[model samples]
Target: MNLPATYEYYAVIPHRTQPAVLLLHTENGWSLPCWQTTERHFWQTCDHINQTIQDLLALRVITLRCLFINQDTGSGHFIRVYEFENRDAQWRPPVNGSWIGFSEFKTLPLTHQMQRAVLEAWFTEQMEGIPTTRRAWARTGWFDETARWIVEILQGQAIEVSEAVQQVRTWERSCLLRVATTYGQVYCKAVPAMFAHELPLTQHLDVHWPSHAPSVLAVNRQQSLLLLRNFGGPKLGERGIFAWWEEAVHTFAMLQRETVTHADSLIAMGCPTRTLDDLIEDIRALLADTETLFVGGKGLTNSEIAALRPHLSHFLNLCQELKTYQIPYALEHGDFGPANVAWVEQRPLFFDWSDSSVAHPFFSLCLFPEEMEISFPDTSDWQMRQRSAYLRPWVCYESLERLTRAFEIAQRLAPLHHASRYHRFILPHMEAKWEMTLMIPAYLRCLL
Candidate 1:
């Protein structure tokens, strides 16, 4: 859809020391999914970020989108991006031609002329195969090329060993990159696994929850690269981090509903009755690898681990109990926790669906109160402790009370909200805990 012509694309000149806003003109309209629009509305509702954006635009920090069209040497079509030098409230002339592709180049100082040359050469390399053109590249695939160029830029930075990484903090995961040409932000992510699957999976999930997800901007699966919306949020355990327990519960409920519907569709498409079981087995296989469970953390000794066994065992029992009941299997946001959630615009955005799966309800909730309490004990405070203690027991008690108060106002209105099936999954986990707890005391004694 053509946005109103009044909207224009603008790129931000990254501050040498601080984060800055990247703005693109929205009057011409941008291609964003309905959900993203909803998310923006949420942002608009929650705070003055939109107003701040306007102020930034007034100060010349943000501008319109620059559409780069390639026409000279032909390998189809691509777009290039150039950041305007620091200016205030005025449209600057485009200094560089839009090349083969565009990505939010990193904010390195280009400290010296050599660095500038390197960046210039990198840009040149991207434009190498493409012919120059006067008109904007009309192709729909410009996004993909933009992603590729960004990856090359970051990867190229890796080769310049003379630059100390100390000043340049390298993120293990991809960084969020914003181009001046688009109103939306894109994630510069290198897929850990087959990157190709990441975009498709994200696209599928986006389609499923169109109202709650960021659209995939681009992908280069072959290079394990992706450029998608950066759903910004506070990190888990950080001060001022957002937590929406109610929203978390609600989203999961919606997911469960969707799972049933999706499963039925899959079955109609010829999926076998054993599909659920097979899926569970696959999940088990993934977890069976002790290394996978470690998640790159330091090894816990058998003794130190033994000390935590009772609590861990208890936690396991709860999972098993719920699993035994089968917990009404549905698609689970496998790593559902604070880290995976962003409090944007007063709503909880459940993210990092990389580990998502169809599992028992409590399986996902494992990452919630109890599991987090155990793993991040040092980080827990009085309030966190209270909430962690309160939430699960509250859920359990409420579910148990459901049978007694089937006709109660709260229970009737939210019947499925406290699914008693939680006990099924909890029971099996409880059983596992029973075994671990028994072994732990002996193991601890041996270690001592």
Candidate 2:
């Protein structure tokens, strides 16, 4: 019987009377390895075949009696073909010879391996022969919703999603897929080798944030797929440095109180040791003068962002000058900034709890425009100028009156909050790298 030009078909020849299935490429008339040639026939037993048949049957396919046939290897192969038949003795035959012995080949399931292969193939095809807009996947609108998104990934249920035209990245190291599904949106960040270790950390943070952040919808532990709630907002980086600075201080204060309250609980649960002094030093170091530091390569001129180093130093110095050790308790947002906070309905929602740590409240206060300048030098000058205008006065205060007030209040706290889980967030480079260490001193000079 002749197969239709439009439809693809496969045929199976049994081996040593073993069951087999054959696949054919209709366009090229090329035959794919049938079941007889695959490891399935050699490693899988007849019982496995029966089980497969049963599973296929559950999928609405009918299995007929197994048969045996000869192969090119001079071996007998056993095979089975699912045919049109009813257990209750029902049969429907085609009226014409055009539709002879009837049956359709089953399509293979698209496993993760298959998806990766397809992606690679597509990428190769698109890039190999012709050159098009290399910027097809150029992305924008990278706003930080770390805190809110973390919550969403942990506790979010299935909800309708909005459509977005997002570019896809295919490199194995940074493979990512963002699609607008009927259920809000799906962003799959694939960290090839570390999915197992990273997935749980994300899930833990998601499930833990029941009240503060967005809910997590699902988690594919094996694939490191974090299905989270899409909290659309401006990242701290995009909010203009000045705006981020104001929000950082307030958020840090609130988070500090929460951190202290939860400190004892976290410590009891095996959390790491965190100290205020350690945090102060870390901020000081990050604000120190450094050369050729990269801030996601945003490319802003040195003058436009030169205030970063001095600004950070000034923040630390102010804390020191005010003698605000009253901030006895410490809890850090692990990684704090406007990127982690979302302005939802006029209220700021903190997110990205995965990096939560125990540090001084002022740790977040370092989120001033100057700090942003240092972190993201590639930012546009207009934005930097706008940020400088907003912060220039605030940084020039004669006294640390407002900052002192905050420290006085924070000192009343009894303990500090830090992660107690096996998962931790310390980057080795932060401690050993000299360039990163100087971020604080440079920023402190801004205030003077």
Candidate 3:
């Protein structure tokens, strides 16, 4: 999809001393630089920084994604951030000319050599925690804070470490890095609220299915962080997709089964619980009070509310019909698919459990092939093969006869259960069309 032509890309390359905030010394004066488009020219900045690290320090670097800036004039721009590990030397401009810190870059101390101004410095507003957010971290900026947290957790466990770490890369609500210390290269992570169960859930597996999951070396659940074996290797893919899926799917089913045994513990610890049984009530309850559930009881007009009201009866009936199966409930990977599992050393370690919800184990598999195909459309016959592989576990538990019956019901009911989540009259997210997909069956069945 081509966005508006006015959109552009820029970078805020950061180092120990300060951030490189696009300073260009023109004949007019020294000013912040920006790009009109995110074409090859913009990528060159990221390319230069990455090359400098790979060649000079022999250290790897990963570039971060866009930090958007919405201007007062209603225009917007975005800049990606790149962080360097093992700061070998204080960074200097990739090109030669007068490049200085942001404070000094503003004074125009070398006004005589200045030539042009590229952008209206949106610096003040943009600097508000944009450098090192909870989602993304800067080593010199927030690594120490994270390091201190790690140290406290380790000291309590009586483990020692070296002063340096191999690298740190932050994403949405977690940080992944290789800590160079007394132990060999160990992988460390700080998960977000959504995936807090990763540590405890894995710890549970250690006792029940140690060979199937990652060993939690050390962890601080309060901080949503943990350390694990680096287990460095490419995740199963490229050519071994089917072989990997069979093992991965079986392992996933096993994990969900184990989760069912400890459902109370996991739920008490804040894992999302959305049971198929409860969904019937949730759909009706939300429909009854649609106005409040969406946006403070005001998001939808009365006409819209009336339109959705009658459909709830049929949706609730379908939910009741599906509940007859009583197909086992457990913690489900709400977004389960091939990409979510990583096969390491022949064992499948399921990652990205952020979408955990309490539902029928088979219900989770309803979209196994559908989800993966959406993510990777090119793969053809493999899609059905993967689905068959995923369904193997269910067959093992109830035989294909029962498994097929349960899954067919799930295909129809899962959509209604999912759509009911937005009964507060809130519109579904544009890209998340799955919500609408859920309601379509009920709408068609009831002619609403």
Point out where model 2 deviates above 4 Å.
1-176, 189-212, 220-225, 236-252, 264-273, 277-324, 353-355, 369-448
Tens digits of lDDT, candidate 1, 1-448: 5332121212333332223323231343321101112112211021122223335444332111222212222432222222322333344323221111134334333222232443444355335632332111111233345445764554553422222111000112222334322333335544334112345556666778755555565565654555555666654434333235445555655655556557554334322232234433333342233332232333334444445334433333333333333235455554566667666666556666544444433345542554355544566473343343323333432463441232122112111121211112221233112212222223123222
Best by lDDT: 3
Candidate 1 contains a number of clashing pairs equal to 50
- Model 3 lDDT on a 0 to 1 scale: 0.54
Each model's total of backbone clashes: 50, 72, 13
Model 3: per-residue lDDT, tens digit, 1-448? Answer: 5454343333333443444343555665543333344343232134444444456435344444323332222433443323333343544554523335456556654332211132213244235534322243433434556667766655666667676453344444356756655655666776655567667765665656666666677777766667775554556444345556656776787677767778888777666677666787776666675434334332444566677677766766766666676456787765565555666777786655555666776656655555556645666776556556656655545667666666666766654554454332222322223223334333223323
TM-score of each candidate? 0.39, 0.37, 0.62
- From the highest TM-score down, the ranking of the candidates is 3, 1, 2
User: Residue 175: error of model 3 in Å?
Assistant: 2.5
Tens digits of per-residue lDDT for model 2 on 1-448?
Answer: 5422221111222111212222323343323222322333421123243334334333111122112222223333333221111222222222210111112222332222322233233234334632332211111112123223433543354443354323243221233445575655556554433223344444543455444455556655554455555666665566554544454455445545655666665544433444645435544444342332333332223553474444555445544544443444444554555666776544456665444444454444343434556755676573434333333333333235554454333322211112111112332312212313223223333333
The local distance difference test score of each candidate is 0.36, 0.38, 0.54
lDDT of 2 at 368: 42
Candidate 3 stretches with Cα past 4 Å from truth are 1-9, 13-22, 26-65, 69-140, 148-168, 180-184, 277-317, 371-399, 412-448
lDDT of 1: 0.36
